[model samples]
Target chain A: MAIRSSLWLEYQIEANWTSPVIFILYNTLKPVGGSLLLLAMYYVVTGGFLGGEGLYFLYIGNAFYMLVAQTLFSVGWIIHDDREHYQTMKYLYISPLSYFTYLMGRSAMRFLLSLLPLSVLIGLGILLKIPYRIEILLLIGTFFLGWIFVISAGLLLSGVNMLTARHGNSIGQAFSGIFYLFSGVVFPIHVLPGWASTAALGLPSTYWFSLVRRSVLGKEVDSIMSGFTTGDVAVRLIIISVLFFVISYLTFRLADYLARKKGIIDMSTTY
Target chain B: MNVMLNLRALKGRAYPRMIGAVREPSWMFWDTFLPILSMAAYIYVYRSLDAPKEFEGFVVLGGVMTTYWMNVLWGMASQLYWEKETANLQLYLAAPMSKMSILAGMALGGMFSTSVRCISIILIGIVIFKVEFVVTSVGLLLGIFGVTLVALYGMGMVFASLFLMWGREAWHLNMIMEEPIYFLSGYSFPVKALGSLSAFATVIPFTLGLDAMRQLTFPSMAAQWGLVSPHLELGILLVMSITLLYVARLSLDRMERMGRSKGTLTMRWQ
Candidate 1:
């Protein structure tokens, strides 16, 4: 019930200000713009659109990344949005609802909202006749795992935001930017240097994106994770996701305690 | 007395932004670090395609100019809306001196902070990426850079007034300005890559400014990438700067009148 209520509230906050048509258009424009930027880069370098393989690889990777980026930012920014912008964090804390669940509700809504862009991208891929050898089962599994990884990271960010006085919003951008680089979102992980690639291996996002690309592109495209079997990826994703969940849960608990003790949880530093 | 008040208001509003970088290590760190990550990602993309070494320089220069574009859009353009939401707009309007001074102060401070980020990116590109630049004429480079900033910030001032009038729509508008502008402005690639599309793109000061800088810096690569000659682009930027600033003053006067009559100037949480 709390989650449902929170979802409705979040929807109102995000969409109520604009006409439904305009809101959808705004959502559509941002992701489409982002993809076009990548496409422009690809075209400039290749000198033409001679090869669809590289384009498809980048397109699929970038589309799925929106889920991680949006969920991470939405959940992370909620702390600042409520405390600083809306001034409702204290009221929310005193409510009967579980704050963690409220955040998860928000995270889930963002992931759902992100699906619009994902669909638009996939639809474009089909329209352009980019071959997609999709395995429905693997695609679903990859999405579930990606959501777990994003939420955990977002939870960790929320915990950190609880302690900051100003610019808690930037925390989301910092995390998303790091993931864009390390997660092989727009390129292969092997493209990174030895140490950086090694660091990428530690992140669940690496395996998550690899599986997402594989689920759509199949094993035809070569990648660092091309050698791993579907089962191997599933096992690694589960392990890393669980590790992140435990860490983020514990961090949020500690942050919650510290924030209450310090009396700064509802502090606003807009200046 | 009025001139002194405007000058004092400008300094007063500018103080925090200039000092914020020094006072907050984390903000400075993220501002410098996050842009580099994206720049590095693009650098790798160009490398993977086996593009020439000069392409790395193109991406680096794009990253530098991007800092200014972001500051103009987020800092100057959307700032009035932010101030309104925070209940600070009423105070600003209620205070003596012109509101344009507040925006001028914001532009000045944002330029300083953005310059720090730009210089850092350039140095990192040189030391780490080993990107090289050719400067045939320092005067030409400086001329374009100055005019581009003036034009860009002048547009930002106009947007600030419009944003105050638009309220909630301003946030969405700002988001639209970001990645789309990056593509249209050829932030990570040559504007000429867009072909006939480059003509429409020239309305954005960054588009011509970035192309002009690239031609000056990478003369050999410029033939393939240059949309227009450097002098023509600079001439366009000069005209744009003058026109935009004049339009900005007119818009501010209109916005103040509309806000006063509509009773929306002090409105919050709309």
Candidate 2:
């Protein structure tokens, strides 16, 4: 347990030091720029500011979506880097420490790191005079649930990448793009086409965004869960998170078994 | 003999990149199809804001132009880092061909691949969103896009040289470029509306090109041309291209000399 925790801390320190300028810039400016871009689009289209409610939706939606996208991509890339770039996957696989525990620790570290940028974005929002109704307890609760749901999906993706070794990066990119499109990150899901909105229904992000927007902006929670209360939404998220965790764990174990059978556990090249 | 060798090197280098990019169907889908999702998101933003229906066309055009920038940043700029990681950098450096020829080949191949994807995206956006373009001058629009590619890829050459010296830090540099450029370049909105930043944005090649193209295609809906005319934008792009290419060559020479002294070219994970 101690070793696992230490490894997680070491990973965080190393990542921070690796091009610290770029790391800081990316975590700060990327989300800021992203939110501004969305707001800019809204401004141009409407010929006016997005008012307080609209600005709040765009602000928290973009910030939270960026966090989810980065966390998910990092989880997949961590596994890909261990196997392909660093060539440390085999040793880690053979180690006594639990891989699941290691992954959870990494996810926890990433979630914590993500908060710095999230706070920066919120500060920008406040400066811009976007209205907010912060329910601290609900915000914290939604964040935890959102992280679990996102991390579980990420683990499943990492496992899928293990099975399809050559396309791991593409797989990650595809998911990020698809999620950004369908998950109501920049706009409400209702604005999407019928088919796309239907697809969004299955994603935990839809519910997560609802909870977040409702908590932060005091917007009404709607969509497939329109009939459900806030508590009902929370319960649904818990159920979805547990379901994703089980499926991801099983998928990861299957991928490990397949990799051993194929004798490609230590393959360094992408293909 | 030297001329023949350079020609052969250019062809040799370019064909492989073109083939490699499409060798896997999945790669093609990710580069081409997946990016449309981003376009879709922007479309939704327009819808949410109740922007003029024509703004959908702006978002689509911006999305299409972004493919070229992606090619420049990832396909060209980061090519050397990828080669170094794969141990091909050493082989290329030892070869007799000029490094410019290799980079040119990569730029050509990247343009070809990304252009195909860009066209697909534009077509999809038109069909799905029913975006109507009022192209007043097709030739002028094409000219803007052509010159923009030249300037953008020339910048890519400079970036490639820098990345050659940067080692693993190149990846972060590439990441840092993505969202900032989209915001600054007015990929989904008019740079004129960016207020004071408009002056800074006009200097960027893609911003100039995109602004000009939008002017020619949707004159009524387009922002004020910071350069006054598309022809001037084309001339600016040409000058920028030549200057950037020269800088790329100079930097390549400097980077090679420094890499040799520091023994960093062959060093991995630095």
Candidate 3:
């Protein structure tokens, strides 16, 4: 526990100390900028009108998407960075601490780190006067549940990263982009094509976003699974999250075994 | 003799960069795939809002043009940082060719590499979404595209100098700028809709170029927006290109001199 907590602290400090200003500005501005851009697109398309409901929807959706994106990216990239850039994979592999614990610790820290931006985004929502009753308990529940799903997804991605070390960052980015498109982050899944909507159903984010929109906006989700009540959706999310978490652990172990057999884990930085 | 040697050096630098980028199948695949996905996302956004059908074409065009912006920011501007990280910057600086020649080579190579992907994106968007392009004159359209490339690349030259001076911070700068540029340049909508923000957006060559291209291709839509004539837009692009290139050259020279004195050029972290 001490080792894991120290590792988390180390990562937190290193990431912030390296470029504090950029870190703050990027986390604060990037999501807000994206939301504003989407809002602008909405305004233009609607001929200069975005209702409070629409604005709030975009705000919560974009903020949550940013959180997911940053977590997935950090998890995948941190694996690549440790194994390749820092050449510490061998040390990590030999360490007393479990790699799974390390990842979970890092992810926990990422969730905490994500709050900075989430707060800023919520503050922006208040400033913009987007009406929403602040349901703290529900918001917290949604955030924790969403983090579990995202971290599981990230772990699965990190397993893929362990297998394909050179292309890890790009693969992570590609996954994030695809999820952003399909997961109803910016638009509802019902609006997507048949194949895409079907594919989205397989991902936990679809359910997660639906619940989040429900909790934050105090409105029922208008997605493909709109018939499901909040409790039903929550039950579905919990099931999927647990299933994926187990699958991700197995994937990581399998990839680790293969990497060791191939003798590629530590030597992957050459390319 | 020196001019001939420099020209030879430029060719040597450019061909390898061009070939190396194209030979990376993953890079090529992702570059083509990501933009189309982004365009699709925006198309969905438009659909959700009940936007006009023509706006799909606008989104597609804007998405395709963004490839150049990516090439400029990542391929050209950040080339120095990559080279620095790899310890090749010192060797390149010590070589016989002028630094500008190397950057020019990178710019040209980047354009070549990105153009292939851009054309793919355009074709995919058009076929998939059925975007109609009513080109008034091919010659005029090409002229606008040509000058826009020059102006955008010229802006890239300035970014390169600024990035080189910033060291590792360039990565953060690149990250910070991505979505904001998309917003400012009206990547998926008309800039006139930006209202007060349009003033800031016009300063970017990308906005001027995209707006002009859209106007030329969709004259009817252009009429509705009261967009500036294509010729005037071209003139503005030309002026911006010349001014940016001139200033970029001077800035690069000054930075190099200051770097030499401060030892910042060789420093790994700044």
Score every model by TM-score: 0.96, 0.91, 0.89
> TM-score winner among the candidates?
1
Decreasing TM-score order of the candidates: 1, 2, 3
Which of 1 and 2 is the better model by lDDT? 1
Write the residue-wise lDDT of candidate 3 on B1-270 in tens digits: 388777877777688656666454555555567546767888887887777887888888898788788778877777676666546678877888787787788778777767887888788777877788998878878988988888888888888888888855676566557678889988888888887878788888988889888887777789765247888988999999899889888977887887788887777533
Q: What digit string (tens of lDDT, one per residue) describes model 2 on residues B170-191?
A: 7766765777788999898877
DockQ, all models: 0.57, 0.49, 0.40
Candidate 2 lDDT tens digits, A154-240: 777777667554432434545677778887777777888889888887777777888887788766534454556788778777887
Candidates, ranked, DockQ:
1, 2, 3
> Can you tell me which runs of candidate 3 are displaced by over 4 Å?
A1-23, A49-54, A79-104, A127-129, A159-173, A247-271, B1-4, B15-17, B21-23
Where does candidate 2 clash, by residue pair?
Answer: none
lDDT of 1 by residue, A1-271 (tens): 9999888877777678799988887777767777887888888877665456678777788788778876775776788888887788999999999999999888888888888878888888776577889999999888888889998998998897888755323457556878888878887778888899889989988888888877888863536777788788789989999999999999999999999999987787643
Please list the residue runs of candidate 2 whose C-alpha ends up more than 4 Å from where it truly belongs after superposition. Answer: A2-14, A18-23, A50-52, A97-102, A163-173, A221-226, A263-271, B223-227
Interface RMSD after interface superposition, model 2: 2.8
